[model samples]
Target: MKNDFEDKMADIMLGEAVTALLDEDVAISWAALTDRLRSAIEIETDEDRIRAGLRAIEEVRREMHVRNGEKTEGKRVAALTEQKLH
Candidate 1:
């Protein structure tokens, strides 16, 4: 997202992903989100596109994680300990 084009791509893709899930009551899991993006949007499965989309997805995931008061990086994300979640 260092460039405008990458940011725009992430924003547009994120919007589509969010919209694809608006009518459902599915859990907000990463797997669910990825599946929705795959099925609902005709994403070209090129490695670069997948990587870019993953980068965008990580933004949302990171925000949610930080909002839940769990600060982590890389592999530490999965080992999140019980903390005072706001």
Candidate 2:
């Protein structure tokens, strides 16, 4: 069905967006990231598909935040260990 195809396209778009986000060598702000997603999704005329893409992007953002927090925590722990050893 057409609806199913649209859903699949949205999923593929979301995957591409997440892959670009993760593959970045330099860090980018959340606002910038969302702005980029919004721009990318602007080409979609279907309201339902747009909303679904946004929801998926939000989930990806949350997961990215969690991963970033974990990385920061690991660095902090390493710093503390080094300080204690000195």
TM-score of each candidate structure, all chains considered together: 0.53, 0.58
**lDDT, candidate 2, 1-86, per-residue tens:** 97677667667767666677778753566665676578777997877768767876776688789999999999999999999999
Clashing pairs in 1: none
Clashes of each: 0, 0
Evaluate all candidate structures by whole-model CA lDDT and list the values in order.
0.65, 0.74
User: In model 1, how large is the Cα lDDT of residue 84?
Assistant: 30
Q: Model 1 over residues 1-86: C-alpha lDDT tens digits?
A: 45676777767777777776776766666667767656543556665556557667777777777865654463365544334342
Candidate 2, backbone clash total: 0
Query: How does model 2 fare in lDDT?
Result: 0.74
Candidate 1 yields a Cα-based lDDT of 0.65
**Model 2, residue 10: displacement in angstroms?**
5.6
Error of 1 at 36 (Å): 2.9
What's model 2's TM-score? 0.58
Residue 35 in candidate 2, Cα distance off native in Å: 5.5
Please give the lDDT score at residue 21 for candidate 1: 75
